[model samples]
Target: MPAITHEAEPAKLRLAVIGSGNMARRFLKQLPDSRRCVLRAIGDRDPGQARVLADEVGHLCEGDLICGTEDEVLTSDEVDAVYIATVHTTHAQLAMRAIAAGKHVLCEKPLTVNHVEAMAVVDAAQHAGVRLVEAIMFRFHPQMAAVRELVRSGAVGEVRHIDAGFAFYVPSDPKAATIVTPDLIIPDAGGLEGRLFDPHLAGGGILDVGCYPVSMVRAVAGAAAGVDFLEPVSLTADGSLSGDGVDEWAIAQLTFGNGVTASVRTGVRMVDNNTVQIVGSRGTIELLDPWALSPSPRVVVRRVGHEPEERAFPAPGAYALQMDAFAESVDGPEPEQVSNADSLGNAATLDRWRAAIGVRYPFERDDAVIPTVSALPLRVPAAAPGGDRAGTGRIEGLDKPLSRIVMGCDHQPDLLTASALFDHYVSLGGNVFETAHFYLDGQAERQLGRWIAARGIRDDVVVIGKGGHAPDCTPEAVSRQLVESLERQGTDHLDIYLLHRDNEDIPAGEFVDVLNQHADAGLVRVFGGSNWSVRRVAEADAWARANGKRGFSMLSNYFGLAEPDDLPWPGCLDVCDAESMRWLTERQLPLFAWSARSRNFFERADPADLSDEVLVRCFYGPENFERKRRAEKLARDHGVSPSAIAMAYVLHQPFPTFALYGPKRLDESRAAFRAVEIDLSPEQVAWLRGDQS
Candidate 1:
């Protein structure tokens, strides 16, 4: 037992409530105000309410009392963090304001009503250099995490849908006269429905109450994305408005990036209770009042892997635990809190659906655009001794930030050769594959088909294919190429599809529509543009927006070292330069480099002998001679091959681009994968760019 050493006292959190609402009251009453936490002050509109709250537990928060305004509370001499439990409309503004005031804010649920406004709030909070949280206390429950664990653990094979509802009528203390009644005088008589119906204030049956499903969607979606909770590709929602024209009830269907979707039904004026059922490929997880309590009501798992099971953890005040965690975070350097932006994005999904359904709020100026809020995020990541540095390594738990190695496949005729290359690449952590119908005059697809079928590695590879290699990027070509590519690779569908070349004359929308149609049919999961110019990329993206089609996710092109005489290929060189690379980085588009090693452009038939191209280049071409000589020296310094230096040069680009390796041998593959782990410093890149430094 190691002599039963005494443990040190845990760190305590300091908290200040910015509102004296019922929820705030509940939080204050339940949570302890001792070492783990202490109330600095309470702010509310009514002095009576604040004083009552301050006096409710005199013994607990002995030194603290109530304040009049948010400013008074935030600027107080004694405080560590603040929690906002005020009106929904005030949520975004107040949270940003608090963050700006240099205080950590845990605003009550529903970060905001719209995506843009929500993003603004996040940006603002970031700018303020303080913590901001959208309080969805239910998410803190272990049962929800338990559900995620079950889904991820493969207990529910691949989850395709989540169906949930949180509904209960708020009659309020034996259901007397409404809040509008003059007898008692309750301000903001609009209540939840006021902001819930206001498109400006972020209202709707969904916005009013759709967070349950939208939040669940975030929990399930594969990417760091704010998925459209209604569209199947992303979301296309419809709502049922109440007598006030706000979303009293709503129905939404959201599709995940991976083709998984959820059917959501949520409302506030419901006649009954709430329930959630997560339907996966294996089975379903059903819970009654899942958002209700810890030990969290009861979780019933009907999974395919095992017989149906029911589990209940000994959850005692899970919400308190969440508050404690947030408080502790504020008390420390970095808080374990998800930002208000995440929560706001989710609520905006509901708001969008409500807007589409004509649910309007008081301040909402336009039904199309959700009301915008000013936002600025302020948290600066921990600095190194020398401050910020480029090509920096990993930031822990980056919310699905970036993939390291870009996977490439050679469209070679010999299926075994490419397959062997792919298998070796996989062994080395490469999964992003690139292929084309016209590769090797279409024989490469057949080879990949046989190879993938033999390896049964379809799930492991993110297969990318091209269809417009032929004259017309027609619907027929799209269909034929997709089917043929699938057949060749022995896959049901490619992970991504690219327009091999842009038919400048063809309306980009038509191509997007064709891709969308195929995508709808599940032939191509993600369709992108290859050899597309910035203008064409913009055009295609616009078309996708106009036609409600999926936009491009990747850009593939021939972009690497040139021998001065190095010529440009159609559409291939559009994004080849440093400026274009910077643009791609800003767009967050994943760039897939073709001919990364530039072997075919310059390398000799034999490693020992420099071919005529290499010989002619080194002796006659001024730029080529300098490039070779510089590469030789750098390779010597790094103890890597000159060819490895070339590969690293391409890999060195900032925006998460991967090299399309066309290695002719296993040794080449060995060298290429080895390059993924080697990150060149800015100095190294500059030296290579100078080529003769």
Candidate 2:
């Protein structure tokens, strides 16, 4: 549909902001539909938030807008394009959804989870014939182009290495920063992590905000495309993983095919700002907020035989320009920037890093059989005084309905522990299991399958497995993945089946239909999401509600017990956010959480053996470390481990929390179970929450 431009010619750009949060809001307000563009709508799961954003944007905008769901906005007669600032994990999915919806898409940086998904997105868009661009908004900053031009012009010489810094000490200004679309852990284009700090999501420092430097590399070295076949002849990477699997800061050296080597590093858990330093054989360039080169974000070049010179350009907002480019592409060919190659390079680089660092993500496997959740003999209420009675102490609305701290007992090559870890959490009364058809290359699910078959305890445990990625999330795929999960778990059905991601391209309703079919087939009981938002959820729920079928009854969000630097899952907390919270609080849909520990502070808890970033922030930060200390003190006072206190904090919330625990040692499982029994007082919970009052 044509946009209602305020111009006398009645020209305007019809635009929608996907994942109406901080970046989306900023992207809209700044553009305010001059004669060139218009805000057509805002899409989000939380209609309240979407409405609020639309109202705010309307006040600032010159176009008509309606608050709606992703489907509404993407498929809207008014929406011609979208600027997505939704959480990171969904970056790839939603990007494709918007693109497939026949609208152009401008997504936040670090598109997709891994290279595989990244490539899939490129293919999907190509087949669908839509324009898609990674919203590395800063790239459009004229200053950014100036910096890149300076480097490309050989003013700084042949770029050999780069040192980029993107960090900030974000004081908790609920408004200073909009809540991350996905908690900090949402996966990046690297397929490394689900959060910025998650080594897996962030793909370490360089992979996190490192995209800026790499994008700059694309500019300076003129080497963004034709990179799939390019491998740094000799690359050595040494980095740190936070308690979970996030990378806080990382250093990697890669020698391109031409002998040009680059080094990249980034750490944001401590400081906040985006700066890039480039060193060529003949000179160097330095840029602050290199990614957002606007209104003065500058670049300086130093030559071998000359004084440092400053180069600047008047930059158009990257998001706006990208959107304009996307709009133009509809009438032309693909864009030179953020093209298919851009997505592929970003994704492939992340996968290579994973291969290089030996980082493992949940996406490694393709399918698994999901086990059916049976009615528990235990009368578990939603919540209790000390917390959920499942023993994690998280105050769910129900008691033994299920337990948090679901341990990954399947044998991982890196794991030195036995599959008997399940028995350990069970000994502590844990009644939840997390497995997938593709987990442990399928062995873990098999182990679970065997256990369920042998024990006949299906009624006592809740089984969760997710599907969709690098492949279709069709009913057949869902069935096959569930069968694999069942085969691995040795079960005929799953207690709960989660869509690892919403195949946004397939209409959210269609995705839910597959799960609903399985439920009908008795292959799974309840349906839920591993990385979905309320918008998608509502789309699914509305479809189900309208059809008189069961909708999502549970939400497995990326919830945990530490400060999240990025949105955990793309649009993860949809059901946990203020609006979703109220809905779930009353509707009784269980809230299951992964990464409950955020990779740190477990008592008998083994240190979080995650990628890297999480460990740094959760265990090293003043606030987190202090909490760990308090947990230690609490443990000393209560005769438990500090880690137990951390788990206890999660258990104290008003939701059913399920944590995925992967302990290399059997003793670690023993320690994680103790968390079920550590009854924390409200005071202790508050202290852990940093609420001294």
Candidate 3:
């Protein structure tokens, strides 16, 4: 590791404490002793509490310390950074606000309530160029450093297994219990009543105390493998939830890619051994007090055929070390601190642990659509007028204009994340959402439906519903699934519908007849086929035209800049080849291209990295690499990402085209939306596909 050098008289980082709770008080107590940072302000929901905290640390400031509400402190120029010691539910919101205000942040762990929020927060911080660190103070402790060194030095050769636990009994008292309901879990309220038992506040033992053992396991495993962190390949958990649905106790077993295994236990209402043990082939290492180091932290190493060795290291308060490290990291991140990736991995593990035990917060439930942290609609520039039909296209038999890019609704993990993504997409003028019956076993349709109902934008948006998937690809199944899809979506009629897969075993006219029946009954407006070959579609349309019924007007197939070398899933079709493109162009049928960017083929810069099996199987070949090369060149010329260039290629086809984009992050959606602004000439499109025109 390289040494971090500082100037002889380094400037002290002006810091503000965002919450005036017990954690904030502890941080303030350590602020006075930190040489690299100084207390500048204290903020809380209650001004009186903020003033109390400010008074205790006011003497350490060179000037008058500001004490006010959290918003005032965030906007104040006196503070350069903020330490968010608020409750679990408020962490993501406050961190986002702080990042938006352009202030460095040291957020308490686990970074947010779940991985979805953590990804958003981390991405925002990176995009804003603001330093953000999860305050897992133990990472900055000297004892952890010693442990990492020992693991890396072969003291515990080839680490094989790890056992860790962090639990303590917190007896339930009637007097200390606040109203155990979702409606009353207030944010930033300094009280100990039902704070740790309320699901709305993201209260539970796994998130509060379980993170310690999980993070330790990751760090120790990373040291053994010579990396910053190693995420578990698979994990299974068992636990008990409180009456309010918060986890009271849990145990998770994890297996890493490098053959390292671990078992971690945590709880707030149960007592267990609070230590970490790393077992290796040659020896074992144990920490007496891993999370909160004792005055003299000890590391016991027991080697094969040798006496047990005991080592002690001087222990400065972990919070003090964390504060100093965060101050230094304003310029650049410290090597020993908990990194953003580390925090994301830890949050994902906790999410899985909670999920395995069926512990879900109220906000994540199906009935609720948690608003964004700001609780204000995002402000985005409207689509440019008269450019590519104002970044939208008209579909036959559909009243609403569909955005050139359609949002795919399969990857969202929960309602909160789905709502946020939908909200952002709408703010960017995107109205079309693509949902299938098989996605997440119908959860996707339910989430999209709930979001539409919550926003009351059912009339303003065009929904694309798909049914008749494989193993149930019959007219009877289509009729049954359409009714369920409508109910799940909370709508009376679908703007557009498609058969998820073709069934050659049955005549194409039978499927067309079923869809037309739904159309006659006011359950469907526009009907089409997904993954159906040209012959099947032509036959279906012929039958519909002869019988005086509605027929296929659009298609959902794998079409993108790069020609797919193979299909990623069974019964999928590709229409990017010359013959299929010509056929579609001749018919002038609208194509809703799925896997539109070749499933991130253009986004990944390295051609040698084959870690993604789908990408390799579908898009890894000489022809696709050449296409990717051209996309990069064009992307540089247009001052956009290769992904944007690929999306533009899809939209620039001779026939009407709309790209189905499934973005797991906000930035990715933004990038896909930008493709509509890019205009590619005919020659450029031809050249991009290696055609000499």
Model 2, CA-based lDDT: 0.60
Candidate with maximal lDDT:
3
**How accurate locally, in lDDT, is each candidate?**
0.62, 0.60, 0.86
For 1-693, candidate 3 gives per-residue lDDT tens digits of: 999997788888999889988888777777666878888888898889999877777787878889999999999998999999999989988998899899999999889998878877887788789999999888898989888888889887889999999876555763543322212222333355477888888888899989999999998888889887899999999888888888888999999888899999998776776889999999999998787676688889999999999998775688888888888888875445688878988998888889899998988776776776555554434545653336889998977678989999999987888987887787677889999899999999999998888777787889999999998999999999999999998899999999999999999999999999999999999989999988899999999999998889899899988888788899999887778888899999999999787788898846778798888887888888998899999999989899999999999998999999998877788789879989899999999998952
Poorest lDDT segment (10 consecutive residues) of candidate 1: 393-402
Model 2 / residue 578 / CA error / Å: 72
- TM-scores for candidates 1 onward, in order: 0.52, 0.48, 0.86
Candidate scoring better on TM-score of 1 and 2: 1
Off by over 4 Å in 3: 1-8, 174-193, 304-310, 333-336, 378-381, 385-391, 396-401, 427-429, 470-483, 502-525, 535-552, 565-570, 601-622, 625-645, 664-688
Which model, 1 or 2, shows the larger lDDT? 1
Off by over 4 Å in 1: 1-7, 33-35, 170-201, 221-232, 294-296, 304-307, 331-341, 344-348, 360-693
Model 3: lDDT equals: 0.86
Give residue 223's lDDT in candidate 2 (0 to 100).
39
Candidate 2, residue 590: Cα displacement in angstroms equals: 53
What order do you get sorting by lDDT, best first?
3, 1, 2
